[model samples]
Target chain A: MAREASVSEVLLDARGIAKSFGGVQALRDVSLTIGRGEIYGLIGPNGAGKTTFFNVLTGLYSADSGEVQFDGARLDIGLPHLVTRQGIARTFQNIRLFANMSALENVMVGRHLRSHASVIGAVLRNRATRREEADIVDRAHRLLRYVGVDARANDLARHLSYGDQRRLEIARALATEPKLLALDEPAAGMNATETASLRQLVESIRADGVTVLLIEHDVKLVMGLCDRVAVLDYGEKIAEDVPDRVQRDPKVVEAYLGGALA
Target chain B: MTTLEGKRRDPRVALAGTLLLAVALALAPFAVGAGAGIAWVRVIDFALLYIMLALGLNIVVGFAGLLDLGYIAFYAVGAYLYALLSSPHLAGAFPSLAPGLHWPIWAILPLGALVAGAFGVILGAPTLRLRGDYLAIVTLGFGEIIRIFMNNLNRPVNLTNGPQGITQIDPIGIGGVSFGRTLDVFGIGLPSVYLYYYLFLGATLLVVFVSIRLEDSRIGRAWVAIREDEIAAKACGINTRNIKLLAFAMGASFGGVAGGLFAGFQQFVSPESFTLMESVMVLCMVVLGGMGHIPGVIFGGILLTLLPEALRYGAGPVQTALFGKVLVPPESLRMLLFGLALILVMLYRPAGLWPSAIRRREFAGAGNSPENGAGSERE
Candidate 1:
């Protein structure tokens, strides 16, 4: 709410987005406006199109009809790498680290778009390429330390603890230096302690000036952390307001209760 | 970890190791001469060529995880290019080309590699959406298509000279030193095979160096990332399509250079040399050694090449000695033993004889932790 009072500009404006998969409408006219430097939470029950919207925003799935304008320019819908290049980095609900690479190497891979090393430069190991590679390693190490996974820098991603792996994924996403960091279920399987630390980490990331769009099932965390919250049910945005107001909305309550009387 | 050993080794130790390796390689033919016929030196030369081919293929199948079963098509493209440019076949087919091109070795090598790389890109473009088994099948079909084209291209235009292939191709030479003839270096007669061995050794070393450089570079990391998980790689801002195409082109160029060297070494090339079995053999070398590890891949190539030859020589003698009469022909017996060896390796060492440290850890840590995630890594 402190950040919401100062929120004057929108970082991401996705309008009239719709997606369907073989007779099932996954998302319908779903729109979202995330403010700069604010933690925005999207909460929904099972099959409420929360993930579908995330997928469409991050370019994993093409929207049937929509326009996403991020940081002023219109975003291309279905090219995932381009989406990352355009300053929006995302983490999957199921962690998708490069399992064979070291944690440090995984973060270095995320720094790929920021670095400029051509094939000739790589094969020759020119001075510029060497310097860039060194910078990449240094940055990756710092990111691991930031995510509290520096001790596991040399460990393969698959070998990391589940909570540590989640942290590493966040570190990798941060390596992209995104204007918007979209996390899909960052606290999905964490213990209470892990979730608490994750909440702090999210707060720190937002403090670093990167806008965060969180999709979480933990209602308490969303209410406590988000400056504003949006609720989706049956492919529609039922409520979008500050956490207190959205929490008290009768429509949101009915939607969460399966809308039996609707 | 052992992966960092090469970078962390003492300079003196590394230099000494290199010198020792050079001495052993320089004397390898003589060492073989002491035990067997000099023809084995030619076999070793071919083995070096195969090492180059295997390393190249490793980029596609091992590093990028593209599973290019049609890799030999690039080799064929290079060999045919060298043959057409360096041989009198072109003149025989067309009166306008009476003098023939007869391009120099330096010009032909790069040209062959470029043409072959272009072919690689051509093969890679449409197959970008494929992975694993489907990619393998498409590549297999592509390889056969090239072979069949070479076999019948003599009809309308005598480019490949039909199945008979181009003969009397020019041998590679440099400044009065021809690899086709023996040379007296310091009064120690270096036979043509030994000379070709040195040339092929230098070429293989260059290829090895390139492969090493590629494996540790940013591009190499992108390749390995794609191999590990394509979707994850894309999420990390890697353009998977371009990276995949680059792998194909780079891998094919190496194959092309090897093919050109092969033509120059044999002074003749036929469609028979570029068979599906040849591609399978090179792939076997990669998988048998260690898919992505350079030293492992080199070991795999040498072992596979020499093991079959060793079996060929020993099979007949052992059969006659054991039974007091010839039981099975050495040719068939050699293949049988080779197949048995491959099966045994796959059964016991599914990660290969010398897997990369990462893969080795994966196999070792399998089922040890509930969060191992090894189940998703069943490649």
Candidate 2:
């Protein structure tokens, strides 16, 4: 299901990525390639190292061994902010919005890397800073509208419904204008209607030419919406292929429902 | 659409309301009797100074979520900077630089702020990784270190004049107009306290303006974002280290300016002035008023500063009325009442007397509201 253009040009490529915490090997030799404009899915049972792999890819946890290449350059996974500046943005499994800030301000905070206003500029409120601030507010509003949360733009993120908070988090991530956007369990605790809208939102996001790599628990959602799906079980990739083939793989089935199925 | 519309107010109305409040505050000194007016002005002057300190601390604790318990160190640095530059002690210590050139308050103000800011960055750089209680402990230690240095630094160099402190500090004056003396303006002789009041008011207004501008800017948003969630803020491309340091430096600069003013008004500087209790009092103002809210902090500063003084005045009369004879001295009763008031405020209004709207909503604990559920579905 990968598009022809995406197939030829990979956006994110991880090779032999591994991480360990003390004696526990959280991630082991996980490798994957996400092409430009493709919606890649990562799925695994609880404690299967899916999140650990995401953390390594996003530079939250330093990989013990491996290299991650984004847009054909060796990604220097330094600080999380530096990784974001390199054009990869991510959301958390547990939504981490700036709860005290308004929805618009939350998105504007996402524009921090792109904006050039300094403390002096802010204190002085110069013409350039004012103009840039206006642009930020306008862009923030547009992003809120894009995520269908514009009506709640003035509302505090914490005051928003759980589903709206998820959407707002996505909007904030999009405000970074990333080449690759990663979502971690975006559909968790969402109703069927909310999940359907989320799927559509992801499709629209991909249509905007932003590549997406998502970790989801809903196998049906992944199978239906993803261009390719990768299955992880016990810190290793058990299957990586087009969603239909990956879903039918014996290892994937066994990982989901015990060894008796295998 | 209805909710958004409901939240909107006419800009003109808000402007008018603010202008009216400013006018009332400006005229308040003149409205009182002469002696009471002087006393009121003195109270207001200290209140303004405390407001500046609280605003500065707000940047660190309220905006960046850095619990700083030793913020008075910066205040002490500013005061001592002013003291050293504009006092005879400098000449007394170094005879070569004798007839020590006393700098004008205007000149010393920025220098004090800059020196305090430098110290702030110096203190902040090492403790960037420490959060919450650990950060508080480091800052508390930093404050005590500055105080101890001020107390004992008279031996070799006589920098701070030991426990004797630096005195004979020059009062601030511009040309013929001196803030320390009564000035005849249009047939009426204005008290020096009135002049000090106006000076302090102007300084307060400037700090308030700067604080409001910073609160609404990208930097302010970054600080608040860091405060709310540092990990998420960093992932969103905010350099948390630099931002947190900036918060400290900016906050310290304000404390420095306030310290300079304290030196000028009192014409004295002592290590005893900048104690741990002083730092705690300023933090209480921020917490009791409402953290991160400018108007609330200003109100907190004024209320706390004046409350103890007010209690001191009323204690004797109240004690006489209650017991027919004074059982406790007014000074002791004042502290007792002040402590009781703080305890009550904390117990009843933990968020603050006047909390920021976000804080109010957070403490309201209505996250699972049905209206929000319906609102999300509408989107």
Candidate 3:
């Protein structure tokens, strides 16, 4: 059954985004736009630099040329917190949940964006400080519940099962209240059962009004779930369209099958 | 102790604990043994002071996951500020803030905190940009910088009395009564040492209470988030730079307050007191207790301090009876044993002797399962 997606507005718009490591070109002349409440999947063959594109977008690596504009604001370099405050959040391909922290702590970190105590207030322990701190703890738990981990709220993040950890990572990301949530391989290590759950979770997130950028290797999952598909090959966009169109594009086929996909 | 039960417990437990701690602190100086009642009182006073230092360092190294090797620099600045302004040596040099309004400790302490906080800000400003080993090296360098400046500035005529040190410093005055002077009570004069010891204990408890409360707060959560994963913390809009500086300044000021007390208590202080070794000692307390754990740090500070003194006085009679020697000979083997202990402990208990519950759960959870395994039934 096909569920109707809400109006899709241009949520993220990038133009001529270029990045290099020394003389090695990682991303060059890349341009793409993601719509509000849209699920976009990015796929490419090994060494095609999809991860590099993720890095540049999240401010882990700076782009050498062009601009990244999200919600009408140009992205700046080296200020990840600002990117976050601007309503953009992401998870790592390798799962970078705070391993030593509880699932609750990881989410509280995301909610830290809303706190407003100057350094002085923290030390003074005034009335406002107390109120702000209590609110953070309360909201952090709410976020935990929203992501379906309220029961295991106090459990260490690393201790969670593989699938649950991925869910918690999403919760932690959502704690930031981002307009767009970027998941770098949310289904990377999951089995089929986990992937099915992830598909449902993605739909649920989009239902909540957040646009999602999913980087997935599972072709079936990507084709079935994504509203739009963008394929990259050798640091250049080879195709961007509906899943069926992306699948038939000869350039995408050559990039994936090294000749022509079935 | 109720806080140990987690934040969901009764609020009265916390409030009662605070009141009980306040009462106990106020009574400690009057019931001591061994050293002069005065000296023992000062020892407890310093113990409370060290507790504050440990609690603050816990935030930077304990909560935030940042390794700071030079936390004593802020302490040195607070000590020197009080020493330079309130002492007789300054009277001869330039008597403006010097002889410092004879301001009460209640007044001097906050000013001391601000002065130390500002120093923390200054040090954190340029150095907070560095992370991991680089940050450690930079902090280490800053510690040395403050130490060297203190030492060098003391020479050539002497605003700081050169290495001669400063003296005739006044103790805190409350209302109209000076704490440094003894008081009349029930036909007997209670000593000033008792007064200061209790006051210091109160301050230590205050810092500890605030620190534990703050750890679970938004800022507290942010510090741990940054510690666990920097890129993620910022992605959450944590303002990593500001949080890091908050940790730095908060940690430093506690040590600074300790320094101020040292100046006032000893009534004499010099550049020699705030050395790089001082920084190492404070770090040892935090590490030995458990980084990022408050009670562990306080315990660490007290135990580490009392151990050496115990060895000195404790072994004296035994050594004299056995080898016809005093307890500790010149140059104790403590340094060797200290390093050996750290290595042994790290091998066995990297989570710390008494780590904060969250830290223990985080690190220990790696191998063991919770009583109910990590994954719920999802029912």
Indicate which candidate wins on TM-score: 1
- lDDT per residue for candidate 1 within B46-68, as digits (tens), equals 89999999999999988888888
Summarize candidate 2's per-residue lDDT along B108-182 as a digit string, tens digits.
888988888999999999999887778899999999999999999998988899988888888878775778888
Give the number of the best model, judged by lDDT.
1
lDDT of 3 by residue, A111-194 (tens): 777778755576686899878767767887887777677888877787788888998999888878889999898998899998
Residue-wise C-alpha lDDT for candidate 2, range A1-262, written one tens digit per residue: 3433247688889999888989999888988888888999999999999888877777777889999999978887657888888889999888888876788889999999999988789889999998999898899999999999999998888879999999999999999889999999999999999999999999999999999999999988998999988889999998888888887889988888888733
**RMSD, one per candidate, in order:** 2.4, 4.2, 4.9
Q: How big is the positional error of residue A84 in model 1, measured in Å on the Cα after superposition?
A: 0.5
Place model 3 in a CAPRI quality band: medium
**Candidate 2: which stretches are off by over 4 Å?**
A1-6, A260-262, B1-19, B33-37, B367-379
lDDT values for all models: 0.89, 0.86, 0.76
- The residue ranges of model 1 lying beyond 4 angstroms of the native Cα positions read A1-6, A260-262, B1-7, B368-379
TM-score of chain A, model number 3: 0.92
Q: After superposition, how far is residue B77 of candidate 1 from its true place, in Å?
A: 0.8
